[model samples]
Target: MVVFRSGLFFLAFLVIGGAWGQTMATVDRQALAELESLAAQHPSSKALVLAAQGHPVALVQGRATVGFIGLLNADTTPTAWRTWAQAHEAVFPGACRHGVASFRVDANHLDVLEALPMDRLELASRAVPNLDKARYGTRVDSVHAGLDLPTAFHGEGVLVGVLDWGFDYTHPMFYDTALTASRIRGVWDQYRTAGEAPDGFDYGAASLEPWEIQLMGSDTSNVYGYSTHGTHVAGIAAGGGAGVGLTGMAPASDLLLATLMVDEAAALDAFAWMQDVAEADNKRLVINNSWGLPQWGTPDGTSLSNVFIDGLSEDGVVFVSSNGNNGDSNFHIEQTFTTAGDTARSKVQFYPLSAHPHAWGQNLTLWGEPGEAFSANFMVTVGASTEVNQSPWFNTADGPFMLEAVHVAMEDTFVYDVVAEAAHPDNGRPFLQLRIHKGNTGLGVALQMTADQGTVHAWNHTHLSNDVGNWGQDFQAATSGWLQGTPAYGIQQPACGESVIAIGAYASEYLNSQGTEVGGSPAYFSSHGPTLDGRLKPNVSAPGVNVESSLSSFRDGAYAVTEEVEFDGMTYEFAKLSGTSMSSPAVAGIVALMLEANQNLSPSDVRDILEVTARQDQATGALPAEGEVEWGHGKVNAHQAVLAALNWVSWVGHPTLPDNPTGEDLMAQPNPAQERVLVSGNLSAQSTYRLVDTRGRVWQEGPASPVFRIDLQGMPPGVYVVMAWDPELQTSHTTRVVKTQ
Candidate 1:
């Protein structure tokens, strides 16, 4: 019985930035000691401390100042203060129940204390998700669609390890009866002695980063309850099904739970306990993590060196993580933020650079800013009444060298929705004419503004501002009605990082009474992609609307994505909240299905299948922007994907096979070119293998190697095999490679 819990019925969350190849470094034993010492300098100190169980304060500073703990407590609660102690009972009766000690500051005096790794504290939100009902046409579209449940679960003997905060072991869904001795099933909790110490992962030793969502506490057992982020993410991996809630991608698959039980958010291993478990239960397969930190904390790539991240991958785990919603809130790829860029426009493009030499009090140029969320080449002119109207015309004097828009055209613009763009629009061409948006923080789209009299340029620190150049000139200044947006200022960089897959939101065809979906689209908050690395993140698109999922049972028990939507003349919160987070899971689930169809399919192989097989029918009927740098391949096609995984007739150098992949006749693509494909009329590449598909798309390409061979996704299903006449890799002798249909 715990008296007071900072966050009950909820567990910690993790961060998986775009580049997940990193993790925490070795703790400077000296640094840890010094931090502890500094934290506990004063006898009255009540600083946050590291403990085996959940973090508990031994002697809280009480209210303000700051103190620290010198040791990692592992014993039961002390009865020094029987009165206060008795009031708070341990939530769980176990060894690692709770390790946290809550108290204010002991004194305001300065006290040398040990400093745990410090990171900026912040909360990130993703674009709501939705299903592609148009492509699917139904909830269970996979049945006859590109990839279905059975095909995806081909990896019945395979495994997937999930690293996150604590889970709800007692939850009905997690306690699937069909698992126990089944071919694909597992559940374990190193944190709690009983039940499933659902959350927390391997944070080596007692090291935790400041911004880390979870921290080491005294009360370890029964620590986590219902974490929205963790639960939602895990649900995508393997959440229990539901009558009203959404089912998981692999409803029948096994689950390996690892939670990082720490207070601070960024600790690599909240404690070695979780790590020890994962190592002992290593299955050499796939692992997904939907957690990461802001790009600012790691200007360099050092953060990608976390030992745990690599160790697991080395042991045969395909690590997956969220690309981060920091584009707007934190240092994102686009220059525009939610408080600024969200508008009633069809597009929300990305900007590359954001530089305010004199305004930001610095000369550095930020490259990860989010800009417009629309078409790069789209332009429009409107009267002062059109919504989402924007014109470069702001300048200093408003506030250093900054820039702000009062009425890009109109008001009420929300999440790319035309909430209020008509306010300034004219009959066709209004006086307040302007374009929608431009630029990505990574790629740096710019607006060279020069103070104009009426629609001049300007800048301000406030959340809202206007174009002030024309303000004082016309005399009627104040009453003249500001021609907002046109900035008469300097240059604003646009299109910074343009090489990656920058994702956008789209709604599913199926709509609720409120026109919502299980996972809808144009997620109001999913930060647009296209990183400073010029890599278009989210390579493809998915539904980002109202998706149904398991509830926290603690935090907002209602539907997850939206507050509530009207369906069939009735209001319901049974569906999940919408966002890219939801969309990503859908894709992840599909990937699992693809693997299930083929045991030999590798991560790369799965990625290729999805990209190539995905449909590219935009409303414009335009093919998906081809290229590995952008759209990768196209929209996901469960039907085609399942077929390809089953047919298993493909090539490595290119996506398409030669005209006749038989044993004799042959044709060459990009014929007489540097890189060409040899389509042997005969399936005679000289490789031996049989491609079998139980449910989803699966294949055995080359001889058995940890990694598999591949070209890209988007392969159609058919009966034909590939014979790789190339080298037999490890064996010096000749070998036969085959691909079965």
Candidate 2:
């Protein structure tokens, strides 16, 4: 009886085990070892570890102080996490569900989670870049048959958003002809800590009204000398030429401003709020980003920053970003090692004469293909002695190789972290990221890296020896031992996203004292690209060289170019500045014009239209080739784009329709119908009209008219194919109608 009972108990245990299934979670041994090492070294430094799935912790590992920003990916809230963490004295500064949340948990309490699991831990990382005038509006207006045409579109009813540094909202260039009202709808200064933040965001101050913006000039603290940068960019996009001599491409468009933050995460929050506000107001929005972070990993459009941009673009929000200004540097390389024992190496020297001295605190990064069976190491040489930091042979995991003062001969002058792993696992390639912190080394240092197998691509953001002056070049020895003639793939983040439109600078004309056209060419500083993941960027080029636009009223003396005229009774300033920054806004303003033409267009539609209608450079007489690095798709032609949009309405119809088209062309006075559309041209007495969608379903049908009014007041905002048939003429007409709120 006892034996039988024991056998029955064993059978029951197996049955219960099958029902329960496997419940063990995966643990990151590498991260744990790195954290333990960090605790052993810096006992007081605040360290934030990430926890993905709830993993189990054994004990307080070491004396090193550590904190955790538990990324609750499973199912939890910031409040709930805070409550649990607070039980052990954890602090919660903020939380973001749209992207990721940041929190802090003490190191002693960190060991309490013996069963916590996590995927990745982002410790932290830390763009002013310098574009164009005239030609944008000229091309756009001319493409539509000149500005004199009866149907002139100046971006009315659309919102042009500028995410930049300083802005002069009181400038007359942002005001109407009477100067009584400002085109600027709002301004959010993220640097200011004393005022109300934008809705849904905890940081930054807000100026909702134009009067409130003008009042900012007196605040003293908010008015900085840097205002000229943002002011000039805004003017190029939507200035009314009140006090400024040059007019923007979309003078009638509304302006929205957001003073930028240093971190991309903050940028994500700002974009989210701006987009939410625009959607609530039912306004078509276009954002111009003139800044970029070069230190960020891979221009493959897969970073968290690009992900946020993708999210925003899905909602019809357009982003125009600068490709960057690092065209002529040996900052990038790609090498392939076929021999089993062969190794690829590079020497990155941080010249002592750099404008940004102190390379000890900067990041030095490299990325490689995953599962390519590669090994990497870097030897840091300062003067006579050499210290090497290399990865373990054939290690599959990425790392955070921190170089402390005691660990190496160099003390206090600099510290850095060398890491190698897959930045985007979904992309099927691994990457190596190296960041040197507290880099105070006054003496120049050299970095030499080697990979065992496969292709190893490298980039050095900290070393800019060849970039001695503005628009400088180092063609002869820039690449040295690395591959040459592939300066492409240097595009900045966010713009690398598939949806964003990346703009580069092209010299519209070189002017003499009398503004004579001497010559023209692509700007040397315009960054080139076929992004890291191999995507052709800088969707198009625009005039950005020595372009004059509005300047800040707050900028005094040397800030203003005496050679350039200041208009608006000298109340506003105008200055000539150049960079991809100028070109970005120029393209954005042109996009605003496109949006004004067709509000139902998506991000892809806009990119395709711009590429198809772009004008070939007059100097080269060539358009951008399939994968041309610089001068992407040639210079922008605004008029052609708008005309293409108008033609697209006849061919592919609007984005509102799915795939099927059962409607014929019917002439409407206004293509983008706001309240009502008047059906007039090519109408028959006994003609009938039917309105359908891409789904092949008819919504409304009525008698065709020489003078007929289509009530679109109650219709949702989208594209509708209007088909009209005349029994007498035996003709059917189809047209696309874009409805707006």
Candidate 3:
């Protein structure tokens, strides 16, 4: 039985005499009968029947059918569910939080899932990462120079985990500034199956030791091919320059690279793996996600992936993601029906052939206002007045879980599929999907729609045969249509996730060949957003345009190499790329610096500091107090953010310090002093004191008698730690102090 409550729908299935039945069913019987008829004639139609009946079914690896299922009761543990799944020959990858587990089974075994006691099932669509930054413009250079503190902050002791693909483990940029030691701690290649997987997981290969990664050299190519995306993103976040003079935002931070399998469940596993590694090493972790897709979740941030991210945020792990690169694409349209039976129409644009291997159609996703319903149909037109064919109307209310129809017009045949839900279980909005196959027909395609009494929002994306990627296409005002699309609400998930910091892109200021100042405005392609739920996304913007970073030497694809260097008898290359994918890592590197300043900072604390210290200028225009769609809180100010982080630590008291004082609490007078600092506190006699920078490099150490003076002359300004130890009492006390130039 499926019941609608508080705008959301819940499913409760009952079995009668070894057959599945619904009580108080919401599915339209006529639509179901039509779907059944189609299934009998087409092998692909069987998957549609499963979908229309409220069972999530998806094609995995172009062969098997897979989905995620939620256990019915608290008594049914994930362990027991996995056991049952294994007995039925179903592959249970792993269990997720909130009692949900993912399964991969043959198409023939898909029906067996119906017999299990489950509360909800969903299609686990693979996420397409936003692919497509830099230094001085964000004021990171000022922080690196220690302009007004005791020691420079280079994200030392911080772990930067990048979840991306196409990593060259042997890239020279992964080495330290001296080119002697590698900064990468580990690499989890989820596509590799020969070697041992990471502990606590059953798939993929893990390269933990540095020698092991070097032995592998690079990850095997996947669907995206032997790409350079991951290496480039990681370079922007933490590359050590390798004598290339292109320093990343946090050059001293360690790296953990995961070449994801492109699915949400696999992504969750990567996060868990990185967290475990961070915990074991006792270092703060920051994960950079430069990829996302709308199909992974509702734009409102209620998907399982979002829930998992929120949980991780509470555990002190920070997440940063790209807002996407569709700011200039007219891929969205919205319509409101004040009275009953209001209608709207628009032409659907399809990408040119070979844009992608699976680019054979366009997908239109519709979301209606709560408690309201809408109906949609597809029309094939010849020229301006002739209608070649029109498919049946599928209403959101009482529609089949899925419906597929065929229309023949002379020598052309058109096939369209519809997936509808009266009320979404997550946000309670009426959701519908229309996938129209281009079918080698050169004719025109358009969408006709009507709503009974509410507003509906629709987004058009290139529909790939593999059901991955979310590249958008335009919707134009056709001969008989008045509605056209706009480039708004373009932020993708998990950037839309409530706790994740979504970053936008802006071109760093530079001088043109004419000697005129240019740039410093939002990148035309940076995704815009005040998410569907009216929450400001792109928490802030960063430098992303024409940003120079490292390229993978193992990449098979041709690239425009900007510079080349010979390191250790091998030539490495660098190149410039642009997209929100670039801007996201710039912010992730800044977050690492903030964490270095105060290891106790939460994800929210990091976001607040970044926003409060963000800079607004002519490029961003005059921004409101709450931020805007394109620029968010304005451009990131790394110098101010680091200062604020230090202040935040002071206000809350350093987490590493002892709560009670034992006449050993250390304090420094005239902190941020230019010439000298007088160290005095509840110190014991014969105590020895050492002044060390954030990087653990000791500046001065000597025997003390409760009070001493340390000269700050010739020392770079930044944050530093002062520690006092009383050997007689076997006690030590530590506190932080700042120095100024």
Candidate 4:
């Protein structure tokens, strides 16, 4: 469920949104086309107050609706409408003439959307004057040590667009000023013409905007519930000028709010539209799209692609979307995101390794079979397997960890911590004990819904205590280290996102609730990567736990949690939300800062900054793969990224060779020798050299190049690298060589 700030929905609902104030009806193409043909007999469809994009006025067939919903088209002449209606008497019969389907419309209609004009939106730099602040580095650890919110990605100047639920733009935490036509630049709502829902809300005859709701309802003006998701994400991107919790990553970047409100088809079109416009506006835009179909299938049709990504490349936009908390279940993925030729990474989750063994079954049970039918039972409690003395040493032996079974019950569908402890057997180091916490609870009064509501999410109270790979088969059977999605065969989500920085989730200590500088470990549930095509995703990681940012749910008058604040004459509460969905934007904000420092850094450079600056995962003990999961390069380190952005290094991702090799030197003469090339020593008896072509085809091979020659007579002229492998001495080297006349 989308979260909201304390005591704030009364007013929010007044505005308008999905399902509540909308309607859907499929049109009859055959009948409608006939009506259009008649309407064409007139001047234009617009003349009838309901025109087709290019059709003319005089072609009419009949009226086609049962009650209040019917089509509205033009009639060239009053009598022609009757003449056409007479011909199609079979289908239209009695109600024949007027129009086919008509949804009531006018000034007060909910469908008369007050959509922010697409062309009217502007870039963000117009608002925050000090937007370039982060570009100038200030000591992070010494003065502002903690989760460095500001450092997550400097955003004083960059522009970011959020395609999420919706936002309460007026919130002070979000710099609504930046969202106006003048501030951060452009703002639009393609789903609305003047901000209206399909079915108008009958609030005593007139619909009300959230502003109007504030006057009549009990909702707070500052913190709204329900659709405040966009607002919260926006705050994380860049909110400023007040409060104590934390500031966002890019405090000055402009934001655009494009409402979807159940129009999935139209929204995809809008995504494409925005890409083109942002580029035209000279804004190197980054998008935060926290949505996707609940399911994905093979590329059976380019249907979804044409509207969302057909011409995205020329626009140079990048995006990051959620990998759905639904995890493996409900997530039918197997197809991958592979284009004939495209770049930019896409990311998803990477479940972590937990120390406890029982965590495996527990974790899988929750995520593996969502929407599946199953049964449950309990095992009887028994005495310690080996009866010990009645002394303290006697082993209770059964607990939350690995152990013999005690009494187990499935009284409730609730999942519990599978822990083991020593009980009553006295001092026998405690025996295996299975404790049962009972009942029907998950996802809406059930353990499932409760989990989705973000109440004590995974990697928090619900996941394994240790990494799953710790015990190998002792825990579970071996599978490739790849993070595969379930029903793994068709197109997976987000992987289809074109250039947006698709990020996987991971924890970082560099950002605080307010984006302050703090330090910590990685979040466990963040999506892992090496997308379908094997590109490391999740541009980078940022602190996504215990985050302190703007409040967008529950009202101020609502009950206060551990800490409380008052706003707009009300008091409310807050908590930290953790997920890769959260981390991606944090990085977006950081990228904004990088650009503010140097506008020349290409999107590729921006990507490299995050990857190269990453500190090797201290826990994983290996570098992230160039096209695999686990730490993508490593947990992001802003200081390092900033350094590389400053050209303190030669390139991104990895450092340039130090201008000289570290050890003994090896050289090759006539390197690309067509007939045979001479090689000198970097000696080791077991060393091997293989001449490989671009397509990975090896032309010749030999052991030890103390002074050997290679013949490549039939090979084409090109550039290649000679790889030297040594097994006995455990050494490897690579040198560039050229060939041809």
Tens-place lDDT per residue, model 2, 109-214, is: 4454442332333321123445323553237546333453337778888999998766777777788655678888778876566678775444557877767787
User: TM per model?
Assistant: 0.45, 0.69, 0.78, 0.44
Q: Pick the candidate with the highest TM-score.
A: 3
Error of 4 at 603 (Å): 2.7
In the order shown, the candidates' Cα RMSDs to the true structure are 17.6, 13.5, 11.6, 20.6
Q: For candidate 4, lDDT tens digit of each residue in 1-741?
A: 222332211111111122222121111111223333544453433343233211111112212111122222343332443344334322121111223221111211222222211111100000000000121122222212223233343454566776654344445555433333223243343222233321211101111243432232222121112444555566666665334445566666766555432223323433544564566667766666555432211111122232134235333555544432322222222212133222111111222324343342222111112121111112212131111111011111222122111222222232222222222111112112111222222211111111111111011112322211111010110123222234221122443343445554444445446977544454554445434333455445455544544555433333223334554555433435555446555666666666665566666556655654555544535552342353455555554455445442222242322233333244555432446666665657768887665445667778865666666677665544466666766666655444533
Q: Pick out the ten consecutive residues of candidate 4 with the lowest summed lDDT.
A: 123-132
**Count of clashing pairs, candidate 2:** 39
Q: State the weakest 10-residue window (summed lDDT) of model 1.
A: 467-476
lDDT of each: 0.31, 0.59, 0.75, 0.37
- How many pairs of residues collide in each model? 261, 39, 11, 148
What overall lDDT, based on C-alpha atoms, would model 2 receive against the true structure? Answer: 0.59
User: For model 1, what is the error of residue 719's alpha carbon versus the real structure, in angstroms, after optimal superposition?
Assistant: 9.4
The reply for model 4, stretches above 4 Å from the true place, is 1-154, 176-225, 276-281, 297-310, 323-492, 496-498, 508-519, 553-574, 624-627, 648-741
| Model 1 lDDT per residue over 96-139, tens place | 11232221122232221112111111111111111123224223
Can you give the lDDT of residue 418 in candidate 2?
39
Once fitted onto the true fold, the runs of candidate 1 whose alpha carbons sit more than 4 angstroms away are: 1-46, 49-155, 175-226, 243-245, 262-284, 298-302, 305-315, 326-505, 511-524, 556-574, 619-633, 646-741
* Residue 731, candidate 2: alpha-carbon lDDT: 69
